[model samples]
Target chain A: MSEEQNKQTLVAQETITAEVNSSDTIMDVFVRGARKGWKVAIDNIIPNVLMAYVCIKVLNVTGVLAWFGTAFAPVMAIWGLPGQAIMVILGALMSMGGAVGVAMSLFNDGTLNGTHISILMPAIYLLGSKIQYLGRLLGTAGVPGKHYPVLLGISFVNAAIAMFVMKIIAP
Target chain B: MEELKRKAVKVPISGYIALMIALVIFSGLMAKVGGGWTMLDFDTLNGKFGLMKSATASFMGQGGSGARDGFLFALSLAPGVMLALGLMEIVEHYGGLKAAQRLLTPILRPILGIPGICCVALVSSLQSTDAGAGMTKALRENKDITGNELLIFTAFQFTAGGIIGNYLASGSALFSYMTVPISVPLAVMLVMKLFGANMMRLYCKMFVQEEK
Candidate 1:
């Protein structure tokens, strides 16, 4: 074979070896992914879940939730929710899991019906995680200073739409 | 010369198009009718709560119901979140995410009014909005996306943070509340989110100046 052909063959062999060495097997990928996934779930989700549990427990036990719900009942009535749903909204403001916890409690006790859940779920899902989204996510994403208000406005609009649409569909 | 002169025929089927169609159809079906798998249940808890009511109504009363039920419901989400996130990680590790990013870029670019690379950020956002936002920020810092693009993207992320994980984790509670299938609300939320993002896109185009 010509010297040029020989050089090409050597280069090809080296490339193949490098590719093989660098590629992880499916099992390895799966294991690594699973580990990372669990870490994320634990780090991000578990705390929120725990927080929700605690928040609901405290609010219910103290009767503060009921009082707060009564105070906000008129506002909630506008959205077809029980005054107690104020807890869910408050919980959502704090964390997504907290909102879920509140919702679960209310749903289980027959405080908030399916229609209420439908209206609240989309609103909470869309608007929850406020601190993380506003402080960390958008703040870090380098959004322009001028756009902040606009973005906030859009968030409210989305929440409003979710609430209205879900109310119509579920109610 | 003859081979070079031969015309290339356009085929209707493409892998990406097919996948997109399948996803839409599947989501529609799931939304209209409930998913087959019943991943979480409150029946046992209901029975237990009934027994508790009869036996120790005064001792362990309604005061703790919120905490007790909330804790159990949160626990119920664990399995689904673990599985969904774990599978996402595996797909990401296998270059499936990258391939998806590439395939989705062109399609998303015109609709979202952003570069194709934004698809990666969008997909990542589906699992964890924070991570997705962080990734988009990195992309912005690296000059992979513009500020206006960031605004539009953030609009989407903000509206529907952690789409799949959120759905799976919270769907049970939502399902119990609404007689409608979980997918129906999910689909509705997604559409509203997309609409919100596009609205931002239009706003940016009309009002905001392009970053130099």
Candidate 2:
């Protein structure tokens, strides 16, 4: 009821309001971050897992991967990997998860060894997101049409170097 | 152009050194010196528990169901990847990335030959390649970074997209299967990716014409 008491009450209300606003901003940042994170994860994982499933089935049923492996065996030999690694490469071209799936199947069957998986892992990581990166991200990003080849070239070159390095040091 | 210009900042050399050191530590290259340090040692832990081994054995025993097993393996990595992406998004939201750009510009400018502003894209790419490329594309569209800068930065991302998160998930998976220390392979990958990026930067410098 006193003037001093009323003034104190007004000041306390303003302080609380300021504190709440600041905390809300921090909370908003975290909530927004979590939502975005989950969105990115789901977007990447679902397609990746699905594609891996399909690739594994196709590899299992068709045996085309084996044929391709035999065909690419010589080239793959240059990289110190077995013919079956073609499956991993093919899977990588589609998605990282697909590559992992293919690698796992090969590992289970005793077609690919630990060294081979080590050699392939980095290459897959480097080039695995190609579909999404090239088709959607780059296209929408307004990169010059001319630069696409250059970008692709970089990815392949990186993969190649990764393969070479991994082959030597994987053990 | 004004917006682009406004975003660019002169990063200090000390900041670059700090970043380089941080990167090395984060990549787990100095594991021996520190008696061992890594964000994920799932492989060793898995070995102790025999979790991954048993899982693989059971999956293999199913026979003709390789697809299902493979799908499950990939799905297993989802949690880590999603968490990484979410953390990155939060960092971006909080302007941590912008601050990093200011600090990392000088270093990136010299090594990758891109402007400092590209650090934002670089950091973004380290969380998710798509996010990085998308951000780079935005920078390019805004003329905040030049065409040459775009190419160089793209090369970097191409080699190591979502570096930390990607490696943590994929690398852990690899280690679980293989017998090597997880950090060794991860270090190898990071080095190779950086090598590829540097090679691309050199290529751009030697071949690509300046966009004056």
Candidate 3:
């Protein structure tokens, strides 16, 4: 590990050990969790969401988003969503927060509404962030490289099925 | 692994109650209740920002696009993220997660085709991806699970890995716009995780050969 990361790890270890040894009140625990949440919101969610918004803006300016809608509409229609919903799915492959960003941008643009958001929600996470998880999750678990495709395929199937289920159940 | 097998934490009855409270908060069932019961809901407690100008517009304003718009939008989600995690931390502190692990042990074998020994890693997987992955590696190195079983468990974790954390933290962005309750999508993703794991199990049964 880099020296910086090593230091951070040491500090984190110290914090964990200290916290465990002490009998903290419930409020202290909540504040600690909230602090972690704030870190996540600032470091991960905000940046990804910003990038997604810029990406959608670029797609809109070039009219590529419209073409995507037109092309994917027929397929996306099966789930009762518009053609534009494909961007959300594509964004989800990389990051869950990005997918939400794309979906929210589309919602703001009047391309999708609450029902569409509802329909797309589970699929966003079901296939959420798999591109990164390939290394962090499957690779670390020592899942053989050969089975990667099968695992990926199952996630895709899960996402597709989830959208269908969401369509039926979304009000 | 021998060293890792330490004594289990004692889960008090309060831990189970905290688990139930966690469920009810995220489930959005309490979102519609009247009077003091509304305190139990997520959205109700997260509340809303003051309107900026027009009746329709809030702090984000309207018709804005691009990164600037995204920044404001994300900022709007900050409080919800903080609140969700704060409550999650409280639940976890009171042994809620341990309570969940105990509950999930009996169901893991039937639902995911994995041994009960995986219960700890499985629960951790829902909150943090790296921790779950590291624990799974330990499980494999210790030979607690077979190769096929590892594949199945990894399949379960790979899709929607970090379910609760990601959902409550990142997924909170869409909570306001969702037609259903906040927890419905989470519920769906979890069920689908189970289904995907089973598919992997079926694939192993049919195609992947077992080593002698």
Return the top candidate by lDDT: 3
Among the numbered candidates, top TM-score falls to 3
What is the overall TM-score of model 2 with all chains considered together? 0.72
Query: DockQ for each of the predicted structures, in order?
Result: 0.27, 0.22, 0.56
How far off is each candidate at the interface, as Cα RMSD in Å? 9.0, 10.1, 3.3
Compare candidates 2 and 3 on lDDT and give the better one.
3
Residues B1-212, model 3: lDDT tens digits: 33223322346677799999999988988877788998999999999889866578997988999999999998888898999999988887766877887788888888888998788778878888877787787677668898889999999999899999899988888998999988888889999999999999999999988753
- Residue-wise C-alpha lDDT for candidate 2, range A1-171, written one tens digit per residue: 556334433432221111223454645754655565455456755456556667667766798877887888998998898887887887777767667767776786788888888888877877776776776556655666787777777778878887887777766
| Model 3 lDDT tens row, A135-171 | 9888767788989999999999999999999899899
List ranges where model 3 is wrong by over 4 Å.
Answer: A1-23, B2-5, B53-55
Error of 1 at B71 (Å): 3.6
* Candidate 2 regions with alpha-carbon error over 4 angstroms: A1-43, B1-66, B79-103
True contacts kept of each: 0.43, 0.38, 0.73
Report the C-alpha lDDT of model 1 over B1-212, residue by residue, as the tens digit: 11111211111233245334334432434333344421122221111223343464522244455445444555555554544445444444434444455566678877887876566567667766656766676567667777788889888888768776676555543454565655667788788888889999999889989887
